[model samples]
Every structure is written in structure tokens, then in C-alpha cells.
Target: VGMGDSCAPSNNLPYGTAMEANLIQQLTLRGWAVVVTDYEGLGTPGVHTYTVGPSAGRAVLDAARAATRLPEAGLSADTPVGIMGYSQGGQAGSWAAELQGSYAPELKVKGTATGGVPADLLKVADFNNGSYGAGLVFMAAAGQDAAFPELR
Candidate 1:
């Protein structure tokens, strides 16, 4: 997913949906319908809640709900779903699985597959403090602060 406003998916900018589009394409190739969501503020009017599991998780589940209700999509609440993601998405997908029961009990989630989840923001920041991904540390910091403003 794009990290900044300049590359938000709603901007219709190139490389906006590059990350998981390939995997989504694979599912489509198999004749399955797919839907995606731009987390809590990634493509909207406020600060992108990057790394915020609850927001991302709710967005993911909500997308599924919306997709199922779309008249043209011909989907229903009974439709099965399998969530998967990598990196930032990995965390979101994992959170979705955890919250699916209480947040969206109607979703028939088959399974969840996630990779490279940032289980601990502190560890992630510390590890990337002086590495090539140093900028990610700052980005994560801004995102975390935005999501948990009381802590700021």
C-alpha cells in the first residue's frame, strides 16, 4: 500500500495498488471475486492509520461486508473468505482474523495467511533505527502517534 498522501489509491496514481494486486489477480484468474480496502485513512481525508491494527482490521472486515452486499457482485453473507497479506497487510489481516468473530460475526472466514507481521512496533522501530529501512521507523512513528493521539 502507498505510505503517503501523494500515493494514496484514491488519487488513481500509478503503483498505488501494486503490493497485493498480483495475489488478488491470481485469485481472480481462478474465477474468484476479490475486493480490497485502503485502510482507515490511507485513501481518505485524514492521516493514514498505518500500523494501526484495529483500524486496518475493521476496514478489512468492512470491505468484505460491503462486497457481499453489492448488488452486482452477487455475493452474500454466506460467501466464504480467506484473508492473506504481507508486511503491513500481514498485521492487518492477522487483526482481522482476531476480530472477525466479534466485529463481523457473519463473515465466513475460512482461514488467514500472513507474512512478515510487525508484532511489536517498538521492536520494528528499534531494528530499523539505523538500517536501510530507517525511514520506515519514522513513518511508523508518525502513524502510531496519529492512531494513539492520547499517547502523543
Candidate 2:
């Protein structure tokens, strides 16, 4: 399952509430179960950590763990899994891949597919200067600062 872009207030949009029905249907048809994460605080409380790699990665892994424990889903702890994401989601997926070997060794992650990943926040900041995406760069910086004070 893919992590989505941005966070909407739970009272307004509620995380994962707007997922495309067709996408879920296609995955189910292919015999792949799905579980998407709403990130740290998007569907709950407090501020979302946005691009903080470790936080996003942990959220994805935790979702995987939570999915396996649902008795009705019939998923086991040994179930093999694959992850995919794009844009901001891509970065999160990539981080999940890096973290899984250590953070969640019990999880059987078969593979990860990431697209349009912004791997380097500083590079994104430098490259987007004076460009339309410059605003995104600043937001990334702010998110990093909020999530990790040492980086600030």
C-alpha cells in the first residue's frame, strides 16, 4: 500500500477516507491486500511530521504490524508484503525500506517501489530556489525543523 501526500485535518477530510475505490478494488482483484497509513498525526492529533524520514518510515511499518494483528483479516505475522508510493509517499516508502531490516525484522518485505522521491531535503531546498516549487522547499524545511529540532 502507498502512503499518500499531505495531511488534512481529521475533522475535515479524515485520513484515508478519500482513497480511490477503483484502486483498492484493483489491488483486491490482484490478490493483494492493502493497508495505508495516515502518518503520525494526520487522522489523529498533533502536527504531522511530513517529510521527516524516520517518522514516516515508522508509521508505515507500524501500520503493517497493525494489519497483521487484525484477526478478521486473516493475515499472519509472516505474510510477505510489498510497498509502493509516489512523490512524498515515495520518500516515505524508501525510508520504510531502509528501516525495515532493522526496525521491523519480523516483517517480510518483499520489495519496495518508489517514484518521484525527494531523497534529499536540502537538495530540494537548493534546487527549487526561485522556482514554482520553492514554496514546497520551505515547507519541507519547516517540517524538518518541527519534527527534528536538532536539524533546526
- For TM-score, the strongest prediction is 1
Q: Judge candidate 1 against the unseen true structure and give its global Cα lDDT, from 0 to 1.
A: 0.83
- The TM-scores of all predictions, comma-separated, are 0.90, 0.81
Deviation from native of the Cα of residue 39 in model 2, angstroms: 1.1
lDDT of 1 by residue, 1-152 (tens): 45676555445424545555666768989989887777776777678888889988998899999999998998887999988888888999999999999999999999999999998988988899899988888777777787999996
TM-score of 1: 0.90
Report the lDDT tens digits of candidate 2 across residue range 20-133.
446666888998878877777556465567788888888889989888889988999999988887777788899999999999999999999999898877788788999987
**Can you give the lDDT of residue 8 in candidate 1?**
59
